[model samples]
Target: MLDLPSILNLSGGPVGLFIGSFLASTLLPGGSEAMLVWELQQHPDQAILLCSVATLGNTLGGLSSWLIGWWLGRRYPGRGLSNERQRLALKRVTHYGSPILLLSWLPVIGDPLCLAAGWSGVRLLPATLFIGLGKALRYGALAGAMGSLG
Candidate 1:
């Protein structure tokens, strides 16, 4: 008879919220916005803290994807992308550079964008900055919308 929402709200807490957001920022289809909004509503005083934590967690997740691509590039050596479509994707990422990593906060293609940035050998610091900025903007926007709703 336990309500699922209530159970999640209780078990997740703040740190759990951050972890969920981190995982969601990866290739996973999960989303942390709902949990964040719920936590914000329940603990308005901690809104800023929660937002920062979520952003950091998400940024780290994006960084993980980037690192994975970088590692893969090293592992594969001269194998190249193997297809025209992949070659085009690599070309675009290489042409665009770190700024393209800002799109990493988007849904679906976001995680892949980060990975592409790495595979293209974009500078790590710049890529991280762009990814962090994008995630911060996304979390800020979601928080703003949720605040307005309540």
Candidate 2:
């Protein structure tokens, strides 16, 4: 039986990094940071390429969540809050608007932030920009730290 990292390692390098980062940004449980650090350590020269790829993949994954929320908003229109989670998400999105998506890189609330942005009818361009920026900053920071150590 192969462990998760072992299995991911078999996928190899940047391609694996992209896949891992994408999944990590989704609702699915995953950790791309380790794979990213491993990849950077192995190929420090390709740091920019790796970080760009991870950011793009992760951004797309977040967009997927946003799309789901868009659909939910369209479907329900004016549905009442079903729970505290929905209430908070709606409140935040309405109050802060698309700029709030800057926090979409956060672990627990990140995905939901994207979802709320979509559900609130936050325009796609701004949502994409903020989400991409946030994820890029995170990957950049990680790569920078790895570079300093290496």
Tell me, by TM-score, which candidate is best.
2
CA lDDT of every candidate:
0.80, 0.85
Query: Which residue pairs collide, candidate 1?
Result: none
Candidate 1, position 6, lDDT: 77
**Model 1: C-alpha RMSD to truth?**
4.6
Residue 87, candidate 1: Cα error in Å is: 5.7
| Cα TM-score of candidate 2 | 0.87
lDDT at 142 for candidate 1?
Answer: 82
How far off is residue 13 in model 1, in Å?
2.1
**lDDT per residue (tens digit) for residues 30-124 in model 1:** 78887888788888877788888888889999898888778878889687765564465567678887887777887777877777777778878
Model 1 alpha-carbon miss at residue 39, Å: 1.2
lDDT, model 2, position 140 = 92
TM-scores, all candidates, are: 0.83, 0.87
